[model samples]
Target: MDSEDLAESVLIHLDVETLIPGTLKHEKCEISTTRKCYSYIKKRTFATFVASKRVSSSPTDTSPVWQCCDETFSDPSSVHKHVSNLHAEEIEQLTTAALDQMLSQSEEAFQKQEDPNESQSDDPASWIPSTSHLSEEELSKGPGEVLLYYSYCQIRDPKLICSWQSELCSRLHLTGKVRVATEGINGTVGGTKTATKLYIKAMLSHPIFKIMQVEDFKTSEGGAECFSELKVGVYKEIVPMGVDPDTISYRLAGTHLEPEQFHKEVQSLLEDASSKNDTILLDCRNFYESKIGQFKNCLAPDIRKFSYFPDYVEKNLDLFRDKKVLMYCTGGIRCERGSAYLRSKNVCKEVYQLKGGIHKYLEQFPEGFYRGKLFVFDDRYAISFNKDIISDCSYCGAPWDQYQLCSTDFCCQLVLSCSSCRQKGLTACCPVCQAKEQRSSSSPSPGRPHREECECTDSRPRIPNDTL
Candidate 1:
């Protein structure tokens, strides 16, 4: 067998089972690097593992490595902030710019695709590797089924979300990430609203979900379809901050102003503020989530992880606290706790948070609450409110709905890619993932796919895949 073939065989046989949950690694962080010189920057406590990938490129125009959003970062270390921050725009910009300069030959779209009318040496064949083409059987299985999540939050369980990918959220046909643990449940599930409703129902009835009021997901009248897969899992904490224990804290509903009161206060605060005093509208959702939508005037932190919200807020504390501080998130839960946490530390002096968070406000002012899309945590991916679709297409730069993402690399992270771009097989997740899959094991490549940032949970402690 060739050297590369030998590696593939070794990888499949080299105890991939070792990466499975409860088998060797308690958490399913299975890794399979597509290339060599894999490096990562992880938090001391393992709360986060920021990694960068280095592709073996040469002066030759001939390389199998389809350099999809892979550039600038000489190694994984420099790419640390890129992944942790979900800097899709920055990555896209840099990669596109670099690819433009090297037009001597386009990257191989995929090795196997063939065009009937075009010459093999002239045009590259491409495939949108995402599961957008859901099979009828898979859709019927649980197209719109909801997967519930909850958390018994505390410092000890501060890192619950990543560790708890053990929650038995319904897999169905959805393909987004989910996590639940002692601290709470958090994730991005995509599918039909009905499937989401079932999941929400289960959570509302769950012992802990009973304490939290998760909104039942709704379908858009004239928007893109929902998630293509129903992925669900559990983690250690609802949100992993990757910070020293001393900096972590969480507070919920009862401790803060009610949704209505908070909303009224914000409206009044805005009216009373001096026009030039600098009223700051802050969006506290993850980067992927925020890319879809935000209040017209809010500072979009566009963070990838929730725990980093505080840090973003602290950085901008001086810019807003002195004036009017209007904060919000997917639901009121985050704002309630986020505002409380900031107030506890005296981070902001004049603060007003969205009552009931954005969800509640959308109930009455769906068309007028602000502008742009609203990030959601269920199968709906996200909803475009008030005729606003601000998120950019990752590939074509068009305004895209929430359901699309590159099927390339860990491009598993949600992103906007136009239909044309997707059809061009430009997904970043799938091509890279497939390349990683085809890579020969002998290269001493990272032992797994780009999983340093995520451990794809194959099954959950409460619900076994075999049972499904």
Candidate 2:
């Protein structure tokens, strides 16, 4: 048959949608639906007719006597027209080029599916080495890593987000706590580098996080068991600031400054004689967080929990008025609402916040002006940014930064106690609690004592010779 007749016969029998590149499988074909009897060719062989390529008689194309055939066309109609006019002798070469392109695409897709590891090679044909064969010594050598990230965008269904996050973390073998709420998502997780990278990729894969980049994540290195297990749940608020979401919006929060810029601005404000009195560096975190470490000369509120921040702000409104307020929190989530609240009141001349909070700052400047350890919510309790000891033992008044729960069996309050004092049985949060505990232990029980009902129960007890 002539090429034109052969092309027509082929086109009449094939599914047009499947023949076209980048077309959806369910897309309706413009051709008649009744015809479907073409002799099926491999996808690689069919790819040749879809695109044009020049063929040389020699591998190097050094000879001048070679003929070049260009059959490439973009639209399906144009490709059909080119195929119809082409001779059957050219079919073999076209099929070969199309198969090469198909193989390239398949390999590209497979490479994209593989995990990103330093040991991975750029050659698509190279086999991916499995970590399964690595020795236990090699696996246990590196320090574990953790990636802490948060988003302040509105979440329509927090429960759904929580469920997806839980499954994703579990599948990746990650251990951390993630809280999803109407306000947004807050998470602090730790795992092997591969698992953390996969977790980040999975998180950004969600439609809600498409705008966020991987650099937006804050990462820290820790031991393998930094977190005990994965816990994902829906909550009223991501940070529990206690303010109504309607009253504040993160979009209206204070100016966000990067670590270097924040440090410069802070130094400049401190040096300016006039602005020094008019500017206030505010710590938006709880008193316990600031007690372990804080920015130099910052006005950290003396509140136990973030919920009491509103009351603290209301009482100290006079200090904020006509001042340029610089605020920050651990991971910047608290500052998102805290700065917005300050702006809503119209009390400060200007409000600026640390972009990623202390965590980001420490990553950039490990020995910056911030002194002592940064209190964290995990079992690590705190991580040191610098060697500066800014806190003292509550019992003995010696320099100490580690936080330990009160030695009293019933109280859960955390207190700083030097190793010597903790070893000496000074575990109570205060002297009053210590004296009360002694009296209770000395007194004889009238009847069987209920551990839960006992007034002198210590929720956290310090084990001797070990840090709690």
Residues 1-468 of candidate 2 have per-residue lDDT tens digits of 454654444444433434432332234422111011111223323443443232445545553121224333434555544543453334534433333443454555546553422333334223222345555444434557877788766567676677677766655567889998887788998877766765677666655665467877888767348777778899877878787776776655777788999998788876776777888888888777999899988888767678877777776777887788989888888888888788777677678899889999988888887888988877788987689999898877889999876656555677788989878878777776788667776444566543422243243221111110
Best by TM-score: 2
Query: What's the lDDT of the predicted structure labeled candidate 2?
Result: 0.66
Question: Deviation in angstroms for 355 in model 1?
Answer: 4.4
| lDDT leader | 2
User: Which pairs of residues clash in candidate 2, taking residues 3 or more apart in a chain or in different chains?
Assistant: 52-72, 407-427, 408-458, 409-457, 409-458, 409-459, 410-457, 410-458
Query: Please, what is the TM-score per model?
Result: 0.48, 0.64
lDDT per residue, candidate 1, 395-456, as tens digits?
56788765654354443555466778767755443344436534534243455565433233
The candidate 2 region of ten consecutive residues with least summed lDDT is: 31-40
Query: Model 1, residue 14: displacement in angstroms?
Result: 68
Q: What lDDT is reached at residue 27 by model 2?
A: 47
Query: What is residue 33's positional error in candidate 2, in angstroms?
Result: 47
